[model samples]
Target: MSLFNMPLLIQDTAAIEGDMGMLWMLISGILVFFMQAGFFLVESGMTDSKNAVNIAMKNFLDIAVGSLAFWFVGYSLMYGADMGGGFFHWGGFIFSQGAADLFFQTVFAATAATIVSGAIAGRTKYTTYAIFSIVMTAIIYPVAGGWEWNGGWLNNTDGIMPAEFIDFAGSSIVHSVGGWAALVAAWMVGPRIGKYLNGKPIEMHGHNQMYATLGVFILWLGWFGFNGGSQLAWGGDDATAASQVVLVTNLAASAGAIAALLFTWIKNGKPNLGMTLNGALAGLVSITAGCGNMSEGGAVLAGLVGGILVVLSIGFIEKTLKIDDAVGAISVHGVAGAWGTLVIGLWGVDGDAGIGIFNGGGAAQLGAQAIGVLSYAAWAIVTSFIFLFILKKICGLRVTEAEEIAGLDISEHGTIAYPGKRQREME
Candidate 1:
């Protein structure tokens, strides 16, 4: 099956048959479900313990709130019906999908909204963040999602020259959506206290690398579903495509980790495991948009470039932009997602581009990808900032400085994640 012409799930009836297939999908969903833990672990592990519980709680709550929001309005708006003018008409305020496909997408909707939690961690009030999460899953994400994924104007399906912008998974649709939101939130929240002293960056190390590492592994495991399940079945076109997608994803991740490790070691004169793991994630995010269209070699190249992009983007955002992302979510997801989306034009199989830099050199496809990038950034930034601004005016958006220094576990939730250590400090 050609990349652009892969069979839809509805076309292949037998491909979805048997209890085994259903089991695979359900299990895949479960795995993807557990990625939330991975996000919490990885993010909290990268930041100080003072904010560990805060980060974890945001991840947990965003999923809870975002899921409900997506079910109510996001799914319908994103996929219900394509408006004539490239907008998605809101279907309704209830959970009613024409098929199981809608439910599957809801899980992805939750994933996208949850990605912002880590970016705005350490400062955002729980209530404010909760409202933002709800708005994101229910409106912002779904509206943009309809643009490309659900046959919106961005699809270019009806243009004079038929052009279809493809996102194999969700480089822009989910990751970039969350990434841009993170950018806006981080900007509004400002840097964490003491994060920038005298206009210089301060190192705020994570409390636990173990938690972060475990989170990376869980995300890696979950990505199998993240990409594979997009094929929408376990047999025939879906099965074959899923298998290839997994292969490419794994190759990209491995290459990314290696590239990041080497680059970090070269620049810092040490093997930065944290950054190396992040590189792996960067590669995954980069490949997500074009995973179905690229060959093995293309996948590796994408991963390698993605690894470098994350390192640079993170450093730039933190040091230059003065944004305290807490978990590097903006770089790993936002920058890398843009890379992945553009890679489709560069390395797509049908394109004149060869397997490497020599083969796929065209500007038209690049322009199309750029359109997707700008669209996502504009929508996410504008809507996120407006929503957060409204939230700040309505109910306050940050906890007290005293509450922050004392730790969110105690101040926000009135409990300690590590009671023993907290007691020791108190005494």
Candidate 2:
């Protein structure tokens, strides 16, 4: 389907499936909202135990603050009527859109902002990160999202290009935006203390493998709504499309996990659990953009690539680039998101209709996808850098060196994730 031609799912209560569609959207939004918990667990488990409480606080603020920011300003800028000649938009402020649309997209806004949390988890000051989340949801993410979803220049293909940009559920518009921001945040925050000793990356293992594992599981489930809900309706062809999207999403995730598990085993002689968990997330993000357009086989291929790329990207970012990402968020979301968006140009489809170069489609679709990917990356990196740099200069971004040793849980927030250990020490 053309990006502009996708169903809007506006209320048509007289239709037989109107209620069903509305319910589907609400349920999907709930599922996506629940992914916040998944993010909380993933960030906490992957980082130091001492910072778990602080990490949780960050996640809490991400949704609480992000939702309001998006609602008050970002939503209008994104979904409102175009007012910037295809760049800026203005709707009535304070979320006048349908409850379902607002609810679903609110979760997505929160999600994009929260992706930065894991990358800068252990070291960033909560106040700095909190303001960054507001800007992310209220401005950065919304502006990029408007370009496509709101029929900005990217989707104005009739006037600007030969084909439309496709991002069924925002691999680039959401995940890549967040992913790139995570990279910048991590860079600005600098590596966690002791992350690099003598310029060599040291192992900073997560405290709880089970938490990471379960977090991925929750995110995996949430991806069904993330992709399927993009269908925007449950009646007739929309139902079929939604089901197909869910199927492809599942296939891609499974393939991604298996690929990572095998890749780690072959490379290191150990089936690393962490790689496997992130592999699943990489798969979900990979197929998110093309799930509606790709066949089952194509989805698996994309997911496998996403999984492999995440592992490689993580290594390059940490070891070569010397950026410390607490949980590989940059690789899983940003790098994999770019790959997912570009791969659609290679092999995307609409049932039997071809929309990909390798599948009998022309390069127009590919070109559009490429532009969208680059646009998202550029927008995210530049905006996040501007905000974080200013924050860094004005007040500060990271915790004190003493606080680094003390851990943010105690220094930032007077609490411990595992109070028993502290209690034993005091005794």
What tens digits encode model 2's per-residue C-alpha lDDT throughout 307-365?
89989999999999999999999999999999999988988875556767776788989
Which regions of candidate 1 are displaced past 4 Å? 1-24, 157-162, 351-361
- Taken over the whole model, the C-alpha lDDT of each candidate is 0.79, 0.88
Best candidate (score: TM-score): 2
Model 2 ranges with Cα > 4 A deviation: 1-17, 158-160
How well does each candidate superpose onto the true structure, as a TM-score? Answer: 0.92, 0.95
| Per-residue lDDT of candidate 1, residues 1-427 (tens digit) | 3233232221122334655566666666777778888998998888778777777777877677777787778888887765677766566677464334555676677788777888877777887887787898889998988887666777775562134676778999889988999888888888888999999999888889999999999999999888877665676555766788888899899888989999999999998988898899999998898777777777888999999889999999999999999888999888899888988777565433332223444456666777888788899999998898898889988888998888777788777678788779879
What is candidate 2's local distance difference test score? 0.88
User: Which is the leading candidate under lDDT?
Assistant: 2
